[model samples]
Target: MKQQNNTKTALIYAVDLLAIRPYSTQQLITKLKRKEYAPEEIQEAINRLTARHYLDDTDLCQRQYQAYINEKHRSIKAIKYKLMEKGFSQSDIQNAQEETDIDEIDYEYTVCLRLLNSRYIPSKSDKLKCQGYLYRKGFNYSAIRLAIEDFFYNP
Candidate 1:
């Protein structure tokens, strides 16, 4: 009876957290552990959430991927790291990428262009600085070069 009560409490806490935002299984487990819940209780809560369809890592990955791409405009590498930090496995991340049909080169070019035009204009006489900024944003050398060329030549 005591163990069952603990499990129920843990499940309620987990549900409350999920009501705020989605969490990966690992993330939720970590959070529950930090709350001093027993590992078995945490696992039980997670299992219940999963069984009830209240927790789906794949769906979370897909939603996060779309948000990063469409809203944050993050580079693929950056997004990958973010997903990893959020407790997504490499296989899950890869699956999300495949489902999203992201074209790396095109995405980099577009992001670079947007960054150049909006944040780092070539007309500022800081072409190298602009390149460095894009590099820090996880764009590759080739994509940065092409974006710079496209910006200066076309504009």
Candidate 2:
């Protein structure tokens, strides 16, 4: 009966995820485990979902990347981090990110302006803080430098 219950639970979980939106195999497994599913059950459910076309990693990657692009405030590095956090593999991140064709801008400058406009005038200490924040937000060194330049351009 325990096995049966697990199966039913997995099915319910799958249905819930599908009803909300599509997901990737790894993403679904991670979510199911979060909800206390057994590994075997989660794997079975993931396989079922994949067979039913409710979970396709490629499609999910494209959709997610496109959504971020449409939102327009994200840099590629940040998008890659988001995908990684969502349990995407390196290959998946590379593939999905490549599909994104946004013009690369100075991420630092862009984010710095956002920070400054929000009234975050940076002193030396604040500069360090902002740098850390951008790093955590997944901006590359180049982008972060551009923002710092803007912040320090107070002549």
Candidate 3:
């Protein structure tokens, strides 16, 4: 049947996509939909993949969070926003954060200080520019203020 063929094709396409990199279930669904696959076919494909344990938002979210923190040194806000943009549910992102057991503010403060030390020059004129740069990098006002103080006074 044509429907059966389409379902098989959808599953094949989904598998090929997964072979390249991990995708959230929603992301995979969107891709299939974009390809003009029927909604039923896409859902069937998604269900099959999930049953195979090939699509797990929780696992992906945790790994992504770890990479953002340990490898990219992304701020907590940036990590959450990035993961959300990648189609992870908010609860999954929160669970990943909790499992990581890192104090968000303190970790961000340390990263902020490190960035400032590496890239910023301490001068009255440059201070404002530096603050703006850190803010743009997803550091909150509290972390930015504290890091700037520590960078200037304690250093």
Candidate 4:
């Protein structure tokens, strides 16, 4: 039947995509829709893949959080926004953070301080510029203020 054929094709496409990189369920749905797959066929493919443990949003969420933290050094807000933009649900992002048990506030301060230490030169730069940079980087005002103070006063 035409329906069966579409389902098969969708499954194959989904699997191929997953082989290249992990995708959240919503992202995969969007991709399949973009490819013009029928809604029923797309849903069937998604169900099968999820049953096969090939489409796990939770695991992907956790891994992405770690990747953003370790590789990108993003602030908590930025990481959450990026993950949500990638189609992860807010609850999933929160659960991932809980699973990791990260003290993100402390981590944010540390990251802010590290960034300041790396880029700030007392002679060439000013506190206002550093504050603006950290703000642009998604750091909270409190973290920015503390990092600036530590960089200028403690050192």
Candidate 5:
């Protein structure tokens, strides 16, 4: 009876957290553990949530990736790391990236162009600085070079 009550309480806590935002299974497990829920209770709550389709890492990955693309304008590498940090499996992240149709080179080019247009333009003095900034933002050397060339030659 005590174990059952703990499971129920853990489930309630998990549900409340989900109401705010989706969580990967590992994330929820960690949160519940931090709340002092026993391993068995946390696992039980996770199983219940999964059975109800309420705890889906794949869906969480997809939603997060889309938000990063549309709202944060993050690069693929950055998005991947963020998802991993959120406790999503590599396979789930790969699937989400595939579903989002994120072309690495094109996306990087677009992000670099947007950044250069909005904030950083590469002049003779600022060219290396701009390249380093883009690199820090998860863009590759080739994409950064192309974007800089496009910005200067076309603009």
Candidate 6:
């Protein structure tokens, strides 16, 4: 009876989360585990949700990848890292990634330039600090170097 109660609670928890947003199976499992459900119970809740199509990995990945693209304009490498962090499988990310455009480097570079202009100045002050800021933003070394070089060259 105690076990039955836990299962019901876990199920409720899963339902609430699914109602709010689609979650990868791994994400749901981790969340359920953190809520103190046993591994088996977590698995059961995830299985139930998946069977009902309330938690589709493909759909979740698609939504997340689209958001990432729209918001961050992250590189494939960075985007893959994000999806992995969000508990999506490589194949799932790969499939979703196909829906995105590649060869968008120029657009990203322009966005990077705007970001750098606001955050990083040509001031003799705080070169390291500015570098660190862009690095943290996940701009590749080449992208940063080129953007900064072109920034000054065009000025």
**TM, every model:** 0.89, 0.70, 0.87, 0.88, 0.87, 0.77
The candidate that achieves the highest TM-score relative to the unseen native structure = 1
Model 3, range 1-155, lDDT digits (tens) per residue?
A: 13444445889999999999999998998888878887888888899999999999999999989888895467898899999999999999999999997787788899999898888666543777878988998888898899988888787
C-alpha root-mean-square deviation, each candidate? 2.9, 3.7, 2.9, 2.9, 3.0, 3.2
Output the better candidate (3/6) by TM-score: 3
Separate clash counts for every candidate = 0, 3, 0, 0, 0, 0
lDDT of 1 at 14: 94
Q: Give lDDT tens digits, candidate 4, residues 66-88.
A: 88888647788899999999999
Question: On a 0 to 1 TM-score scale, where does candidate 6 land against the true structure?
Answer: 0.77
Collision count of model 4: 0
Candidate 6, residues 35-148: lDDT per residue as tens digits?
777777777877888888888888889888888777755654677798999899888899988877754566456656776676555655355565566577777777666677
Better of 1 and 6 by lDDT: 1
The candidate with the higher lDDT, 3 or 5, is 3
> Which regions of candidate 1 are displaced past 4 Å?
1-8
Give all candidates' CA lDDT scores: 0.85, 0.70, 0.86, 0.86, 0.84, 0.73
> Model 3's lDDT to the true fold?
0.86
Any runs in candidate 6 off by more than 4 Å, and if so which? 1-7, 73-75, 123-136
lDDT of 1 by residue, 19-114 (tens): 998899989998887777877878889899999999999989988988888864778899999999999989889988889976778888999898
Q: Candidate 3: which stretches are off by over 4 Å?
A: 1-8, 123-125
Residue by residue across 49-155, what tens digits does model 2's lDDT show?
Answer: 77888777877887887787666566667777787788777887778767867555643356545654464655534777767876766666787777766776751
- For candidate 1, the per-residue lDDT at 121 reads 52
The Cα RMSD of model 6 versus the native structure comes to: 3.2
- Report the Cα lDDT for residue 114, model 1: 88
